[model samples]
Target: MTIVRATFLDTPTGETAMGAELRAATDAALRVVDGTIVERGAWADLGGRHTDDDVLDLRDGLVLPGLVDTHVHYPQVRVTGALGMPLLEWLDAVALPEEARLASPDYARAVAREFIGGLAGAGTTTALVFGSHFATAVDALFDEAQRVGLRVTAGLVVGDRGLPEALLTTPERAYAESIALARRWHQSAGAGSSPRTRYAVTPRFSYGATDALLESCQAVLKDVPGSWFTSHVNESQAEIAAVARLFPDATDYVDTYDRHGLVGASSVLAHNVHPTDRELRLLAGQGATVAHCPTSNAALGSGLFPLRAHVDHGVHVALGSDVGAGTGFSLFKEGLQAYFVQQLLGEAGLPLGPADLLHLATRSGALALGLDDEVGDLSVGKAFDALWLRPAETSPLALALRHADSASEALARTFALAGPADVAGVWVAGEPVKS
Candidate 1:
């Protein structure tokens, strides 16, 4: 058992009258036993009771739940700044070509290490990573995640069309490879237990996947009972127009996946930047979650996310740092950009508060990935997945934090000014993953 003393801030789990309010614990102690938080209370009480237990003092800064990334591409880490091109053009000019290089096992292993390091260094403990087109590369990703102990749900990215020939796979081969990868990495423990690394049936996007390939993706999900599903959605007008032309019978971009029964509670579709009202309704009714990749949307010149419309329609929303096009792995940047996007939309935007930003970055992502029961907040029953923000004393963030007027203001400033450099420490399941 270990006891950690810190000033922790997390969003409340479940519904409450205090809606979107942050749960703050100043000078508090958490008793963690085998990675799970067993006890939490004021330090004065828990400290006196557990006098002999090992203590990890983190009072030098604020502790928050380890950030959760709902959508990020594993192969695109090296191409983050290949910007100025729109979505499809960016994929052709930079992203896809880089992704194809992962076919080399040695290259994949090296990229996997750098990708995992980038995530942990940026304070993300749990992520829904879009895996590579190559099965061996996806295996390398799971291997690195397992070695590092980060919670990752990733799988072989399958597409039968609209991509380079090297990245394409037949439907039968896609099914076989996906099932094989899922069998290997989807569960480290016995069946029904949540493993640190799981599988997600990723179908690149509607324009890239044919009806036959998507059917195989659905079959993979059916075979693996608890595996996840993720894909790109209405991201840019040009991409949407291409998808519309490909699937003439489909009503919209969401219909292309929904027609194949791919949208559901287990599905996480990224970048619904131009989702129609009907698409939003279908997503909400099916209990699917949308990953709002704010930075990528702006960097690719995609339109502002319809956050207010999604909220009004009861669609679940989570933040994703769509790295490569997204700028970086920092959730702080994503949250800040989300705030900026909403502000730029005027009445069409949902004015977000500090609590809202925090919730979206952490708890909202956990809920989206169906890991809320295990690792979202600093609640007693959750895993001790957290990050400590201890900016250098001479830095502007530190000086701003020292003179902040309130906890909310401090949190706002954190979103506004903090970056990966400010993340002094990060832990996942009671194990220190970064320092």
Candidate 2:
């Protein structure tokens, strides 16, 4: 068995903060055998013995469940921070052109490596990613994620309309390609003892997919149980207008997906900035999740999300970077932006606390993507995907948040506050990936 000592916080029951905190001034033992958290309570458990195997001495620093980004576009990593513009114009000028480059297998592979590395560096262990349209690009992303031992759910972007011809896929071809990719990746053990890599059925959005294409994408779920379905919803005013013009028979944008059987427990819809009460209720009733990309919303002028409304209505809400459009891959920054965005809406008249932000980044995100059972918490039986945080010596959580530097600092300061630079180490499964 292996033992590591640190100040640990595990979000038991997925309610945000740890119901309890375990602080060991000297040392606390962590038992890991065969890549599982065997024991993690008190130092004297297991015969008062400790093994030298991978003992991470976090000192007084914090150890929490690694951040999980519920929504992000891996192919848009290169387009982040493009000059601000509305959704359609941004897509035309920056987003689409940058994503189109992924057609090159070598380019996709190279970017995949960097994208995964950025996630680890930002303390995100698990993510629901959106890969580029090319099947080879999607394969390249999966390969890189598997090599890095990161838990990722990604899919080939299905866009048949309103996009460059090179990026379009017919309804029939989109279904076939998605099914083949799902069969190849979505499982716990593939070929041998290799860990599972999930595949999401990603229809770029309502505007880009026809009724036939959307139905075909959703139909794949019948064959692949537990597969995730994601798409953009109610993001921009123009997109909503386009969706309305495209599906006039449907009640709203949400209904368009509902007609295709795309709204369900395993569905993840990003940017519900303009979702109506009916749509929110549908999402809640169907147990679908909405990934709140506050930064992207602000960057693309996509109006603020009704976070309080969503939470009050019992919708499953999680955090996302929404990269390129959302800007920044750091969940820490996203968490702070989430708080500010909500505060602007006067959410309870107070900003979200660190625990609230942490919840959205961890358990809530995992639940949104339907991976709560495997990740999001550091329970005894859960996978040891965690981030080790070392706060500056001057502060012990209190001082960090009080003196925030950047918007990202405002969020990271709440947890560690030193910055991403203070992220001392990251571990996926039971192995360390960064330090």
Candidate 3:
């Protein structure tokens, strides 16, 4: 058992409603047994109560819940700055060519190291990663994620058309490979009930995946009891048009997936930047989550996210780095970018606060990936997945943090200036992965 004393900040409870407030504990302590937080209170009070337990003092800077990334590609970690092109063009010219190279296990292993290192280094303890087309590459990703103890949900990227031939797989192959991978990593022994890693049924997007492939994807979900489903939806006008052309009978892009029974409580669709009200209502009614990749939207010339509309429609939304198309692995950058995009939207925006940004980065993501009960916050019964933001003494972020008048201001500065370099420590389930 260990007692962690820190100046903690988080959005501990509630939905991502407007005017959400931070749960700040300037001199707080958490009693951790194994990996779960058993108790929490003021440092002076909790410390006196747990006198014999080991103590981890982190009062020098702010400690926040471990960041959660709902949508990021394991294969695109090497193509981060392949800029200057729109979505389809960039995927064809830059991203797909690099992803195809993962067919080599050794190369996939190397990329896995860099990708996992990037996530851990950036204080991201939980992520819903988009995996590679090759089963070997996905295995490499899961192996590295397990080795590092990051909470990951990923699977093979299956698509039949529109991508390179090497990346394509028939519906039969997709089902077989997906179930096999899930059984190994997600359902090993009786671990399926509470596995550290989980599987996600990832179809690249509607444009690339055919009806047969989607039906097979639904079959994979039915076979793997606790598996998740993720894919792209209405990201750009061109993509939406293409999806419409492909699925002429469907009502909209969301319908293409919905018709196959793919959208649900466990589904996390990325980049619904241009979702219609009908789609939003459908998603909300079905209890699905949308990963709003703000940076990726701006970078790919995808339109501003309809955050206000989604909120009004009762849809759940979370943040994603969408790395490569996005800047990097920092949720702070994503949060700041989310704020910027909202500002650009003017009255159409949600006008987020520091608490809103923090919520989106942590709890909202946990909710999206269906891990809220275990890892979203520092409440009793939740795991000790957290990060310490102790910037270098001489750094500007450190200076700004010191002079901040309130916890809210400190958190605002954190989103504005802090990055991976300022993350001094990271813990997942009470075990230190970085320090």
Instruction: Report each candidate's C-alpha RMSD, comma-separated, in the order given.
Output: 1.7, 3.7, 1.2
Which 10 successive residues of model 1 have the least lDDT summed?
Answer: 12-21
Candidate 2 or 1, higher lDDT: 1
Sort every candidate by lDDT, greatest first.
3, 1, 2
Q: Report backbone clashes per prediction.
A: 1, 2, 0
Per-residue lDDT over 171-281 for candidate 3, one digit per residue giving the tens place of the 0 to 100 score = 999999998888788844265323678899999999999999999999999888888999999988999999999999999999999999999999999999998889999
Best by TM-score: 3
Candidate 3 structure lDDT: 0.93
Ranking by TM-score: 3, 1, 2
For model 3, the superposed segments whose C-alpha errors exceed 4 Å read 187-194
What is the lDDT, from 0 to 100, of the residue 414 in candidate 3?
Answer: 96
lDDT of 2 by residue, 1-435 (tens): 556666565555744322222222224556666656878776655435554465656755567788999898998888789866899999999889888899999999998998988888888899999888999999998898888888898888998888988899998898888878876787742562234478788999989988988888878766677788888999989999998998889999999899888899999999999889999889999999899898899988889788767776778888889987876778878877887886788734335766677778898888887677777877778778888877556655546644555433444465433346657788887788887
Error of 2 at 47 (Å): 8.5
Model 1, residue 13: displacement in angstroms?
2.9
What tens-digit string does per-residue lDDT give for candidate 1 at 261-331? 89999999999999889999999999999999999999999999999999888899999999878999999
Lowest lDDT block of 10, candidate 2: 17-26
* Per-model CA lDDT versus the true structure: 0.92, 0.79, 0.93
